[model samples]
Target: MHIQNVRKWCREFAEGHTNVHDEAGCGRPSVLEKPVTKVLFADRYVIVREIAKLIGDVSKTNLDKILTDIFNYNKACVWWVPQMLTDEHKKKLMESGPTHTSPAPRRISLPNSVGKPLNNHTALTWLPVTTSFQNLYCVLQ
Candidate 1:
């Protein structure tokens, strides 16, 4: 609290105003509600700092709270599809389709003494397989 505020409260108490609570216009009211709503409607993925820049006066922390509490909007995921996808890219994805299967697992030929032929089963035994080289490297402790 400000020293001026403390002194004013003390004066009020001495002058018979027993209520310690402040009067109606103690602090500035929030000016964020409209600006936040407008920006969100324009682009839902806008960053909080970007919105603060647009508003100019609002702090990022205050704007963030207003967004969460009053607007009830969480930050969007950045991992989704890119903003612009070329037609060629879309066509390629469509051709690939949802059920694209990986190539057939190639067999890994190891020395007979080691064990059975290693394929995807090597992954189960906590071994890494180099598919391009078609080989398995065993790690010795």
Candidate 2:
């Protein structure tokens, strides 16, 4: 405890306050894990604000804490996925391929003519970009 808190508690005790524990309705309200987990699992793309709206009586900060600290969830692309993949999740990911795990395939659109508007002759092309899953390896290893 902080020194200030200790001094204050000592003074309270000197004044004959026998209660050592905190009184009721003190500090942050508790958030239930089951409801939060259910909402999260129901929609992988759900944001904190949406969760707050659905859950009610819960702050975004508390939701974030529940997600990261309690559940070990992390934002991967637009999806909320587990920070640490279990053996089953890993197997599914491997079988489904990396593309399945990604929210969308990265692509770069290239116009043949930068300044000119597209006509019958103007060609637009998209180059598929590959992202390395190096971060996953770092975490998993």
Candidate 3:
């Protein structure tokens, strides 16, 4: 193979699209190291060589194979919690900002009273079951 082919092979291998499958699907490593070594320790796990023999012991060749073995294209979708302002932030906003509230009307309600508006004077009348004559007072005010 030409030197250009070697470079192309290295690049392709780093992307982890090599043909290494059995009757079952091929297993790929979780991560790939920048420079392939005898042993690469990832944050999750240490990836040691599965096969002991080293056909191409050089860093470039080793890196290519290791990268081809690991670094799967399939990515798992995960829900990530983002950083947000805390209760302290809300308290600060409340202290610095103007407070808002609904306005309450100043009026009283009577249990059996119904109110109506009229421009003319009206007479007030009443009926009493227990007494003989019942009177009611009213003003135009």
Considering every candidate listed, which one attains the maximal TM-score? Answer: 1
Q: Which has the greatest lDDT?
A: 2
Report the C-alpha lDDT of model 3 over 9-29, residue by residue, as the tens digit: 788779996853343545764
Ranking by TM-score: 1, 2, 3
Candidate 1 per-residue lDDT over residues 1-141, each given as its tens digit: 999998998898899999877689788877778877788666554677788898898788898688777666555322222123345544644554434466442442223312333333322221222221113221210
lDDT of each: 0.53, 0.55, 0.32
Q: How many residue pairs clash in each candidate at the backbone level?
A: 0, 0, 0
lDDT of 2 by residue, 1-141 (tens): 799999999999999999999999898765568888788666655678888999998889988887777676666441212234456655644554436456532221122212222222323221112323443322222
Q: How far is candidate 2 from the true structure (C-alpha RMSD, Å)?
A: 14.7
The better-scoring model by lDDT among 2 and 3 is 2
Q: Which candidate would rank higher by TM-score, 2 or 3?
A: 2
Query: How big is the positional error of residue 137 in model 3, measured in Å on the Cα after superposition?
Result: 84
lDDT of 1 at 51: 85
TM-score for candidate 1 = 0.38
How many angstroms is residue 60 displaced in model 3 relative to the true structure, after the best TM-score fit?
A: 1.6
Q: How does model 3 score by TM-score?
A: 0.15
